[model samples]
Target: MKLVIIDYGAGNIKSIQFAFNRLGYEAILSKNPEEIKTADKVIFPGVGEASSAMKMLKESGLDTLIPTLKQPVLGICLGMQLMCLHTEEGDTKGLGIFQTKVKRFSQNVKVPQMGWNVIKELKSDLFKGIKENEYMYLVHSYYAEHCDETIAATDYEINYASALQHENFYGTQFHPEKSGNEGAKILQNFLTL
Candidate 1:
């Protein structure tokens, strides 16, 4: 199957490509809209500032292209945050695929909760083989807030939507590609979709 990963000048494309390669899938990293639109599966992965990421996406036109996609689309980290309607990070605007906003975690807890964290309240196909309260890799300061589309929840300083699903659109705050075996399964499930 053809997997097109959006390379809007900011995504951590190599890790995602490595993940799919380990699964025996030849995933292509491309910024071309045609490739993205026609792919069997699409991954929107990123690791960077929201505003700068959005700026790059807008320049490439993927910001407008992604939300309208009919096939399965997965966003990781900043890509997931960009799928939301807005973000307090840099006061940025997002693709609005999910009606949620990204915000900074409460100051009481550590910023950028980097490392493995448990994700529970699983309720979608994305978590098909994943167990409840299973640990996943995370590294972020901003998070998507509670929303109807939220399928998996995680708790750090506060409970928030760690993963979201709405129709063919899917997103994860944690790095499934970096989360090991269970994380690999999640990516496999996404590919199967």
Candidate 2:
């Protein structure tokens, strides 16, 4: 199956590419709308600030294209935050694929919740072979709040949505590409879908 990784210039494209490579699939990194539209599956991975990332997507016209995708689309980390309606990071508006909102973590624990954290209350085929409370790698100062689309939840300083699903759209607040074996399983699940 053809897989396209949306390269809006804000994602960790190489690591994502490598992860898919390990899964025995060659994923193309492209900013072209035509290529993205025709792919069987799409990955929207990002590792940057929300506002700047949104700027890039808008400039590439992907901001408009992404929300209308009929194929299964997976958004990772900052990419997931951008799928929400809005983000507190710079008061930015997102692609609105999900009705939730992203907000900065309270100062109670730490600014960015780094390292491994277990994701619980798993839902969707995205966690088919994955078990509940499986550790996923995460590094973010902001999180998508629990909403109707929330498929999995995690707790750090506060309880938040770790993963979300709205029809064909799937998003993970953690980096499945960086989560090792379990991460690979998640990506494979997306591919099989």
Candidate 3:
């Protein structure tokens, strides 16, 4: 199956690539519109700030193409954040696929909640075989508010939307490629979808 990882020059892409390799699937990293449009599964991975990443997407014309994708599209971390309507970070607008808003964690909790965290309230086939409250690696400050599209929820400062699914589009605030065994299962499940 053709798996394409969107490479707009804003992510920790190598690890994601290696993760897929270990899973015995080749994830092609491409900014090309045609290559992405034809893929059976598309992985949108990002690891940087919002506005600039959106800029890169615009430069590649992916900003327009991504939302129109007919196949399953998975957004990771910043990729997921950008899939929302808007983010408080950089005061930027997002792709508007998910009807939610990204907000910064309060000053009470630490910024960039790094390390392992449990994701519960699973609601999609994406978590198929993945047990509830399973630990997944995460590193982000902004989170999408709970909405009708939320499939999984995680709590740091508050219970917020950690995973979201809107029809063919799926997103995870945590990095499945970095989350060990459970993470791998999630990626594998996505491929089956």
Q: What overall lDDT goes with each candidate model? A: 0.93, 0.94, 0.96
lDDT over C-alpha atoms for residue 33 of model 1: 90
Model 2: per-residue Cα lDDT over 86-179, one tens digit each: 9999899999999999989887888789999999999899999899999999999999999989999999877899999999999999999999
> How close to the true structure is residue 120 of candidate 3, measured as C-alpha lDDT?
96
Model 3 residue runs over 4 Å out of place are none
Cand. 3 Cα-lDDT:
0.96
Pairing residues by index, what is the TM-score of model 3? 0.99
What C-alpha lDDT, on a 0 to 100 scale, does residue 185 get in candidate 3?
A: 95
lDDT of 1 by residue, 8-88 (tens): 888678999999999999999899999999999999999989999999999988888998899999999999999999999
Q: How big is the RMSD of model 1?
A: 0.7
Worst 10 contiguous positions by lDDT, candidate 2: 103-112
TM-score, ranked from best to worst? 3, 2, 1
Q: lDDT for model 1, please.
A: 0.93
What's the residue-level lDDT of 24 in candidate 3?
Answer: 98
lDDT of 1 at 38: 94
lDDT preference between candidates 2 and 3, better one: 3
| Candidate 1 collision pairs | none
- Give the Å error, residue 68, model 3: 0.2
Q: List runs of model 2 lying over 4 Å from the truth.
A: none
